[model samples]
Target: MERKSQIPRKTHILVISQYFYPETFRINDMASEWVKRGYKVTVLTGIPNYPMGKFFEGYGYRSRRKERWNGMEIIRIPLIPRGNSSVGMVANYLSFAVSGFIWKAMTDIRADLVFTFEVSPMTQALIGCWYKKKYHVPHYLYVTDLWPENVESVTGIHSKAVIYPIQKMVDYVYKNCDRIFTCSQSFIEPISQRGISKARIEFWPQYAEDFYRPVKKEDSLEKPKDEVLNLVFAGSVGYAQGLGILVEAAKILKSENRRVCFHIIGDGRYLPKLQESIKANNLEDSFNLIPRKPAEEIPKYLAWADALLITLSKSDVFSITIPAKTQSCMACGKPILVSADGEVQEIIREADAGLCSDAEDVCGFVDNIKSFMELSTDRRNELASNALHYSETHFNKERLLGRLDEIFKIGA
Candidate 1:
């Protein structure tokens, strides 16, 4: 952080995220990409707390901790960690916002613009707005989740009693930011209806540095099979992912005399229930559920599968946003199964990766699976190749984020 500001900075960028590396969220990639391009970047984030809702070992609340990763400076502070539920989650988010503001305000170097991620830090966007006013830090806000709408659909946490204030809070933050980011291709309509102009917003998708490159069939698989098709889902087992539908589709595939296996990997609050559902359905032989693996291990699984599944809930809120897994899956050069509709559907069609089913329609899910399974080897390989090409050109970490560095003037 002591690097000369006279390095002719286009602008100094301060990324305000409740999660970052050592924590592992999309913000880390975004902030780091700018640094790679010679930007002077600093990240203000909370203690490493996620999934477990507790501070990561060796790290605790109070006082600021700083470290350098790949030339970028990451500044982590103590904040109350919240679990993935209403009360605790809100408290966790509030604490980060409160703590980040107190600590960031006292720093010597000022930022030109502040960028805040949408999810978590439920109340932190308001604090970012306050910073914009106090230090004149023009801002960029990324709406990763649609908030009360998404929370209600996933957790049933809000009502008219609770939503109105949240809406106002959303409005306050959006109104103040110079430009807003809506990562999902589907998120534009809802907020645009609320007064955020289309011109002020831009699309930013999750990126993984093409680290998810296509895995060689022989090098990546554990139990290799030359003739059978394998399909996989590699993220959370949570309700928001609509994984129940994946299991249902697996049952259908089994009935059809198809040989494809469904591989689900990742741990979440919903894992136990998912296991129970599998047992109740007697699907032990057809589906395989595995624990989450290290980040470096993902491409191997993608290489092991013929196609990858990506889904969002039937929740009105989730339909508008494409999950990051969709991009990761495509990056691996695997064909895609995008079960959620709208912009997500458009993305798959555009990529020529694979087909989408009607949201929540198990019958359609089964049909799509069968069709993909029935494809000729040449056809399937062609689709997979198209998906990989699309991802590299459109979603790679370096190419997709140049606008971000330009906006912050950090790498300009």
Candidate 2:
């Protein structure tokens, strides 16, 4: 008698992130990585509009378009473009909400799992709940931001009238998802208070193993050999990043070191202000502001620096936050100067991966810079070695995604 063998099923995983590559945001790297692991990845994302707030060039507000990149199916829907304005942000979120739902309805593929990325408002999670109800699929809600709390903190909008419903919406998101992920530790208590089981929540920390990697200098960052010292700050220059302090520190270090220069990369709202401060302080040559380079280009900028600097504002949203750049810099084999406090403090201190100062301690930061340059190659190499080893062991994207696979059975 011949026995029949059962064939394994291919996992068709649907990831709902409003911002994806080509569109340009956080999840693109995640999405691209998922595609490598053999999961049938379908992204339910909006039209290309992000940091620019206008539709990304070459992508219009089309009804639907399926793009195939490296065996992954990217389904893009029309979303209202948004920028740094209140009205624009609403239109952007609503556009994706309405269009994503419409596209989801039209598609026949019932996903094995849905992964949602959190952003400005909590409403995005509601859309995931809708798909779960509509298709009987489980979802993992990923929180990059804590919604109304962060929005209110950043925008200066505080009123119970506005806060209640938004808080309720956040609660709804926590209640509905099968699994929850947050970028900040501050969210743990607040989310647990909502009665969601702690076992269901996980933290991704701030990481990107792909874009951030250790590379030899000269061949990578294309930086001219420095005579005195060079410091680099990569990633978005938003208000939350508190980049101006780095500028101030550079200003103070100006007279001390002739060759000391701060290379600030990436762009954001605070960029112009940071630039103005540099000019106002007559730091045109000492403080250079460059555009945001592609993820691959980050290592170049990082390798160019003698040390990496990562910081965030003292906002409640930031206390729990670990800037993704920290992980990126660690992977780049450069010792870091971390400025945020709390969980971020513990990570760097425990790993001996980088140096840390108070969020606004310009002098302490300066002292670290002085110390970093004076350290022998052996000491610097030790920090670089620890950072690389730690990133490889804990922050491996494939390993993280593999964990997600077990939790959600993504590619099983």
> TM-score for each prediction?
0.90, 0.91
**Per-candidate alpha-carbon RMSD to the true structure:** 3.6, 2.7
lDDT of the structure predicted as candidate 2 = 0.75
Pick the TM-score winner. 2
Q: Which candidate is the best by lDDT?
A: 1
Model 1: per-residue lDDT, tens digit, 1-412? 6875564654567777787877656677667667767667878777877766777677775534787887777888667777656688778877777786787577776877788887744577776787788888688888888866776776676778778887887788878888888888677777777798888877777776546788887788455345667778887667678778877887787777777677887876678888998888888877778777765687886777878998776877777777777778888888888788667788889889998986788998888888887889898988999988888877867656766767665311
Candidate 2 per-residue lDDT, tens place, 112-165, comes to: 888888766567677788788788888789887777768787778899887888
Can you tell me which runs of candidate 1 are displaced by over 4 Å? 1-10, 62-64, 120-122, 224-228, 255-257, 410-412
Clashes of 1: 1
For candidate 2, the TM-score is 0.91
Candidate 1: clashing pairs of residues: 11-409
Off by over 4 Å in 2: 1-8, 23-26, 104-107, 255-258, 410-412
